[model samples]
Target: MTSSGTHTVDAVVVGAGHNGLVAANLLADAGWEVVVLEATGAPGGAVRSAEVTAPGYLSDLYSSFYPLGYASPVLRGLDLARYGLSWRHAPDVLAHLMPDGQAAVINRDPEVTAASLEAFAPGDGDRWLHAYADWQQVAEPMMTAITTPFPPVRGGLSLLRRLRTAGALRLARRLVVPVRKLGDELFDGAGGPTLLAGCALHTDLAPEEAGSGVYGWLLAMLGQQIGWPVPVGGAQQITDALVARLTARGGRISYHARVDRVLTARGRAMGARTVDGSLWRARRAVLADVPAPALYLDLVGAAVLPPRLVEDLAHFRWDGSTLKVDWALSAPVPWTNRAVATAGTVHLGADLDGLTGYAAALARSELPRDPFLLVGQMTTADPEHSPPGTESLWAYTHLPFRRDWRADEIAEHVTRMEQVLEDAAPGFRQLVVGRHVAGPADLERENPSLVGGALGGGTAAAYQQLFLRPIPGLGRADTPVDRLYLASASAHPGGGVHGAPGANAARAALARDRALTGAAYARLISTANRALYP
Candidate 1:
């Protein structure tokens, strides 16, 4: 089905990542003739699985858990279960292991999570429940606002309505407060604070950073509401479901077709040309599921982009690089605390102070002597991830981007990462029957979009968020070039397994193609772009 020569379609979706696939599905669903061009031989992009460590062991290459995927309305609406997408969860959602052998755990049951916190300190259990209650008041509007496009007309209005009843000022204050402060203000024990801080670390944000509270609170609340679930077989199942859904709807995907340039005419994106000289023409739009820099500078070229956009791209910041180590274990991780064994995900850092120190080191562009590790117990979450009685384990830690990551350096760092685990789980190294290490360079090589191994598209920092994502503009999927939409993690609402970026782009394309209002919508978007980028 990989057509070579010239072909015309309603839309040409560049990159068959989840976002591109999502965009293709939405467009195809609307009766558009959409074609997806993927550079890789297969789809899935970062959300993939493989037996890198050993046979019969499946490790999620990049992202593993999908609390966001479960919560995403876009993914949920697709009803992927019909396409063989089954979700699996661990006995407990997550555990934050401390050096002293005590752990803080979050379970789907509030009482269980609260009781776990209460064990560390009195009154924290009730406080956790209170926090969840507050979240419920605005959860609908908040999620809508986050998942929707910026300016979020409907979602913003709904949130405004909820604010009146949900303590407007207090809620607004909480949204911007640092996670460290929020944790201290809400709970008396380190358990609650540590748990929140651990969640915050899921992003590039440190606990002390402003707006970190929102990320932490959002993720913690989602974890409480919906456990961090993984696909039954592997991460590939999610992609397979998306692909299956797309193809079933008569969408076509051309693999090994790396889009070399977005073909533009005057000021409009008309199609895409692959590196191998194959041109896929688009009658309606060309949605790029690549990174912002890649989309603007490399694919479209700066000559055609607005001068301000080119300038803005220069100052764009990327999140920290990553070092991931996967292991095919002979047995489960022998944690010092038995409770940690039941959790699917584990956050390893000594304490709040240790986490702060680790973040500070990353901020300073230095490798931490004690890195904060986000470890996934794949087999604990889903049995299909590995052989019977054995564990498929992987842990990734962020590192400062470096020009060179030598083989010996990666090996040494692997040893250090294992040592950190050894401290919390005695004999953890002994269970490793085989292991695979992927540094920042290795990751970017596997997926070009993962620049410098920095995931989350770009930094999740406040400065680069909302209307400021990728670059300050309208924050819609629309690019300076007409009929082109940026439908990748680089768009608003940023990263995670959520398909909001792609969904938003699809909506924008559809809105611009409407019979009566299409012209007006296109004019309004183009006019706004001119006003901002001029």
Candidate 2:
């Protein structure tokens, strides 16, 4: 029999994604009676691994390659390894295929990577090395500030300290400059711009967008430093590990329990009402890991939101459109270039024009004649992801976020993507044994948090980042109302499998639930930083 009671918990987490899991784990560790409510029948939201097409062949449903995953200090604190989590990297970092049979391969060894750039342009190798060296001066602290739950003052102080030691003025310009401009100014070879642009395309934004080049450089350099790695098993392994950890600590998760509305009492979130009209009360607070709009508009009534916050939410921009295709291949993708065979990730495009054209097409709400594809050859990175001699491949491309293409049109988009690959590798399509496709609508159906099918919750544009995320003045996880916090990609510092939002929300919740355990709790946070940062 289902247990029904007015059971009150110390805190309630509204979603069971990675961020929510992080917040739940931290709070549970802090001795809070935490209960996690998940919309799906499982945890991990976008970070899930499943057998969508065939049995024994697992696919990372959303997030496959994780450069940020390894860089996330928040996840490190969880000691996921003890709960059965590990990582594996690709042999070659990545490969950028050009139109004229020319390719630039980023090797794990920075020297080899620089040499490849040198082959394309004589002095570019030296320039690339210099850029990386300069990046090293601030990369550590910069990552700290960006990911940590620092307020404007603390955040600024962190940035200033990093910049002070490493040329402030130049770093300032780099932060403001559009990615396209940065690429043009830094790299002087035919390979340079395309390589930089391909990396920028990882997000839904165009390379011409301001502040986007940083992501490209950060990710590319990160791949060089630590190759793009996947979990030893599949993405689900990460989720399962988190679940294992939570259960070990006497915490529990309720899957297929979609919380329809957040229960409120006297203007503050009290608990959540499930889709079945049942309510679960929380003694302290409720943390929501769903998208900001979904949380504010759907779960909580719009009237409850502050006017300014509502206005700001109206302006939040979801990233460009995405169409995902997962393939069950009989054999590995045969590339004419051959080097890409060993590479885990491939950025497929003819040249800069081709990429820019792809973006332009999206801007006009139309699919490009030849879409630039970000393909993840999963089996190449984790061979155990599929059966022997077979490969699992997934590719996604951005389109106009609102484009409503029909089935035939989507087929054409897939055709164009295949054409781009086939141009480099003849007979590329023949290797496909089974295939599955998901457009914006399908993505939303799979995970409601991907509202409008937004992968990163919302676009990572400058206007939407930091103080302006979700809405202005709500940056520190806490909303206008006390004890009601947002712990999702929609919160500060934006998305990825990094558990910063979750950790941030937990800290805020703990601080609010004080007085009773003030001194005891104070001692714990002092050491929490060491665990998180170390």
Sliding window of 10 residues with minimal summed lDDT for model 1: 159-168
Deviation from native of the Cα of residue 250 in model 2, angstroms: 1.5
Instruction: Return the top candidate by lDDT.
Output: 1
* Among all candidates shown, the one with the greatest TM-score: 1
For model 2, how does the per-residue alpha-carbon lDDT over 220-239 read when each residue is reduced to its tens digit?
87887777889988888888
The segments of candidate 1 whose C-alpha lies over 4 angstroms from its true place after superposition are none
Error of 2 at 76 (Å): 0.6
Taking the tens digit of each residue's C-alpha lDDT, what string does model 1 give over 1-534?
577789999999999889999999999999999999988888888889999999999999999999999888889888899999999999999999987879999999999999999988999999999999988888878888888898888877887787774577787798789999999999999899988888989889888999899888998998998889999999999999999999999999998898899999999999999988999999999999999999999999999989998999999888888999999999999988999999999999658888899999988988898888999999999999998999999999988866477888778878889999888888988888889999989988888888888888998888888889988888889888999999999999898998999999999999998999999998999899999898
